[model samples]
Target: MSITKSYSRPLDFKNGRIEMSYGAGGRAMAQLITDLFAAAFDNPYLAQGNDGALLPMATGRLVMSTDSHVVSPLFFAGGDIGCLSVHGTINDVAMMGAQPLYLSAAFILEEGFRFADLKRIVDSMAKAAFDAGVPIVTGDTKVVEQGKGDGVFITTTAVGVVRDGITLSGDRAQPGDKILLSGTIGDHGMAVLSQREGLSFDAPIVSDTAALHALVAAMLDCGASLRVLRDPTRGGLATTLNEIAKQSGVGMLLNESSIPINQPVEAACEFLGLDPLYVANEGKLVAICAAEDAERLLDVMRAHPQAKEAAMIGEVREDAHGFVQMTTKMGGRRIVDWLAGEQLPRIC
Candidate 1:
């Protein structure tokens, strides 16, 4: 399983730009795959060099999820699109209470994109996969003409395994269930927004993008009666809660003061006339469990580094209307509705 090396000069990464020939299925494409993608995402499955990866069969139920990342600013304060693609798909699989195993990535590169930038993104993806103990076992690359595409768009697919007797789903939520939030919200959306709009704050806001399988494993091992797990992503906590509420045919009551948000992000949302609840988040998750096991799950969640700021934010209630309501700090109640439209486009 070896790639044929070219005898000609190596790629001019510093000054060269992607050309159409790179995706023409010729020697240039082979060399690009060998020198760049395969080298960084080196693994036995990928090294096999077949049309598709040969994966081992698992005994448990399998879960698969795919995500496409098109964040406007490819590179931001804490992360770029490369790592974001990996983390986003991994989190999706983990939300099903499964152990992630492998990933497949496909990249659409603009013809004039810089080689140096592509290399940086590929390396970031490699590091993220390595740190998460998952491998990019298969992938495809294509180049689009200039002006036909953004700098790059990455689509990643993840597969995971879940043992028997451990089931989680949005419809599993029931009355008297406690809702828990992993940590602070709006960091990712605000980070991207600040960079795109050239707005600076007293303290820099960085995207909270990270793999959360480890944090999920801790909660599962604690023997808590968990019923639902969801990462509040594009629609933020408000929209995500509404989704779960509709799925389970129930309602939610949240305590405004209980939800955690970074001070800088709060300020940015205020100045920009945006509600943090509808803002996107890439690294935060929401969990629901029986009211009796709420404290136990919260203890284990707080013990994990990814969820140190975890808090019990709300509770599920029996309501045929399937509404999500919140209690503000001023002792007023209001409905937490779904996002009306695109609050921030391409924020991921």
Candidate 2:
């Protein structure tokens, strides 16, 4: 008989708040996992109920990365905690020019989290992992008292293989390299903001959350000499570029009009006193490559479904101060400084 055969009870989610007993390693916690987590995230590996997963490793340079998701509202415009958790870590591993293989997720749930809602999140996550051709090989779960935990928090760790001859990093960008943005900016931030404040607008502001490994693979196939790869996340494109510029001892010059932003996102930033350049993004990425390869790289990016709106936003420059400046729509220039304060915390 299966070890979990005797474990059968519908989890009490209605009117039940998280208590210390839920986190305790006993019948209560076991029941919670058997009913809620194990049921929703069912998979051959997960169903095995082992402490860890044993698997085969691919031959090549190995790359691994981990990220934790705690985005507010749990569910949002484009995606929820489930898909975001998978995308965030997958992108991290892919940024290193790796093909992500396996994933492990750990969940921290607050007592009283609705079973229906939790199911939605887990199902979304499992589907993402499946679609990405990756598996959630192992996981752990813990329940905290109602007040002590958020609705849910997920930490995902991914392992992948780095394709030979494909090297990537932030410091690899060089002077005269071209900078390409995956697509429009600030979609993720505006979506979260709208939902948080109960605000509505004429044009819908959606988050640009997506998996980018396929896009990166396309670039590699196009023979582009990619020097660096970085996803513009919490601090947005401006911050990510600044970090790269400083690391590479170079400067950046951006064409304001060339960068793309959705109409609603632009208006929302104007109303909220935020800059789309500095707002958080989930689905966009920054690729720096040799100037000669810029056009070819752009061609590859534009051909991909995720990067159909790709644009060459800027170029690496020689600056003594390692500054990042932009040519505004008015034809005047302004220094794009590092973000001084948190624009939107808990965005990722």
**Model 2 error, position 196 (Å):** 0.3
The sequence of per-residue lDDT tens digits that candidate 2 reaches over residues 141-167 is 788878888888999999999978988
Judging by TM-score against the true structure, name the best candidate.
Answer: 1
User: Which candidate comes out best when scored by lDDT?
Assistant: 1
Candidate lDDT scores, in order, read 0.94, 0.86
Those runs of model 1 whose alpha carbons end farther than 4 Å from true positions after fitting are 1-6, 197-203
- Which residue pairs of candidate 1 clash? none
RMSD of each: 1.8, 2.0
lDDT at position 174, candidate 1: 99
lDDT of 1 by residue, 1-348 (tens): 999954776888999999999989998998899899999999999999999999999889999999999998899889999999999999999999999999999999999999999999999999999999999999999999999989999999999999898999999999999999999999999998888855545448999999999999999999999999999999899999999999999999999999999999999999989999998888889999999999999999999999999999999999999999999999999999999988888987
- TM-scores of the candidates are 0.97, 0.94
